[model samples]
Target: MTVIVRDLRPGTPADIEGFIRVRHRALPYVFFSPASVLHGLSLPRPDAHARKLLAVADGEIIGTAQVGLAEDSREPGQGSLNVYVDPARTGRGAGTLLVRTAEEHLAAHGAVKLFAWVLDEPADRAFAERHGYRPSRSAHFLRLDLACAALPPLQDPPPGVELRTAADFADDPRPLFALDAEAGSDEPGDIATEFTDYAAWVDEYWNHPHLDRELTSVAVADGRPVAFSVAHTHDAGRYRTGMTGTARAHRGRGLAKLVKNDSLHRARAAGYTEAYTGNDADNGPMLAINKWFGYEICATEVRHVRELG
Candidate 1:
């Protein structure tokens, strides 16, 4: 079989759908839609040089690679490329071709270091290792049966702290951004990211197509957002927590749990039958909180890195 790699034709609706199809088959724990795929390719920063590639065999899409430079990273020459092949169609040379095409594209863009996320499965890990990538931090994907699982009862917020949604701050989301930046920096990961570009954050996150502001819960103290749970849904009965975090000053007060619980309750009530989120394996506190919410680990992935001179 001749597996050839080519740039994704964003102008073509079928190409976008095909890319999403392969991604959904490879990573069912995460939601992918044509809009999300298009946003990723067209909304990235100019310097990011983001490109989406597809591995086609016999006129069918068999694999995909999302390659781009980390323009927002504080570190220089850093790049990221996450490849996914149809689980039912592995070992067809598509994965290798996609990775090679991606690496070449990133290298041409002056990427000095590359990062990829490989499923913790033996075969996936072995493939990354064979490509000179070393394992790093890991994260767990969790899912909750919103239709059957018993969610923790939503509790009333403590006095002086009111609950709101991201939609409530549509006119002024700077406070939410500040809280997100603070909490994101504290998140456990191998690559440290600083969300200093407010404009970029607004475009990439706040205004994202999947973000459901009305479903996102925020905990406010003294009229300021101290914690938030960002929600995303695809109108397909699946809901996901894009992020849930509290400001450093508000930690240890259960604000993170407060917002997340509120969001989950709302999601369940709004006809979403499934919920998903991810946590760094080392984040015991968050992991415990999620367990208390009846979320079970469905899958895991390990971060891998390779150096490029």
Candidate 2:
């Protein structure tokens, strides 16, 4: 059977759903929704040039690729093309076709460096290496059965600290943005990203399609947001941790655990049955926190990078 690669049509609901379905089957670690897919395509950042690529065999989508440039990075000419093939449809040339098409698209737009995330399995890693990509840092996907798992009991806030939801900042999310920028800068990763674009943040994150403000727990101290657990609910009865971090000055205060616990409890109370989150392999503190909450490592992916001329 001939495998064909093409650009995903955002206006076609079935196309979007098919693309997301293949992604979920191949990489069940992260969250994917029709809304988030379209939101990314609608990004105002011209440099992103984000396009969804699909590999089809016999009228069925068997692989998906998110091809784009990281125009926002401080480094120039950096791009990303993450590909995922349905686990049941491997060895059908769909993966290779998707990657080749995505690379051509990114190269046409001036990407001198490319990065991709491959599953930690031997075959996945070998495929990346064969494609000229080298391994880098690794990350883990954790899952918590909110319907049955025993979560850490909710605890009272330490003195001077109060727990609240992101909705509390509906009038003004500037403080949350500041906190996010500060905390996110300290995360472990190969790419050093700085979030100075407040308006963009508001458009992409604060107003995102899946952002659950009511379930997003925040910790405030001295009238400011010190820590937060951003919640994203794309599928019914399922919750994903969009971002969980504490301000620099608020680190080591157990605030991350506090807010995350609160968010998990809120998710459960609101009928969410599953919770998922990702962790950098080197992020011991956060990994420990998630472990304490009964989150188990369900999958791992290694970041891979290739240089282009």
Report the number of the highest-lDDT candidate: 1
Task: Name the Cα RMSD for model 1.
Answer: 1.0
List ranges where model 1 is wrong by over 4 Å.
none
lDDT of 2 by residue, 1-309 (tens): 999998899999989999889988888767789889898888798778888898889999889999888766878778898999999999999888888888888899999999999999999999999899999999999999999989888899999999999999999999999999999999998777889999999988998999999999999999999999999996668899989999988889899999999999989998999999999999999999999999999999999999987
Reference-based lDDT, each prediction: 0.91, 0.91
- Per-residue CA lDDT of candidate 1, range 1-309, in tens? 899999999899878888989999999999888888778776858898888999999999999998888786778789999999999889999999999999998999899999999999999999999999999999999999998988778899988899999999999889988999998998888776799988889989987889999999999998899999999998889999999898888889999899999999888899999999999999999999999999999999999999997
| Candidate number achieving the greatest TM-score relative to the actual structure | 1
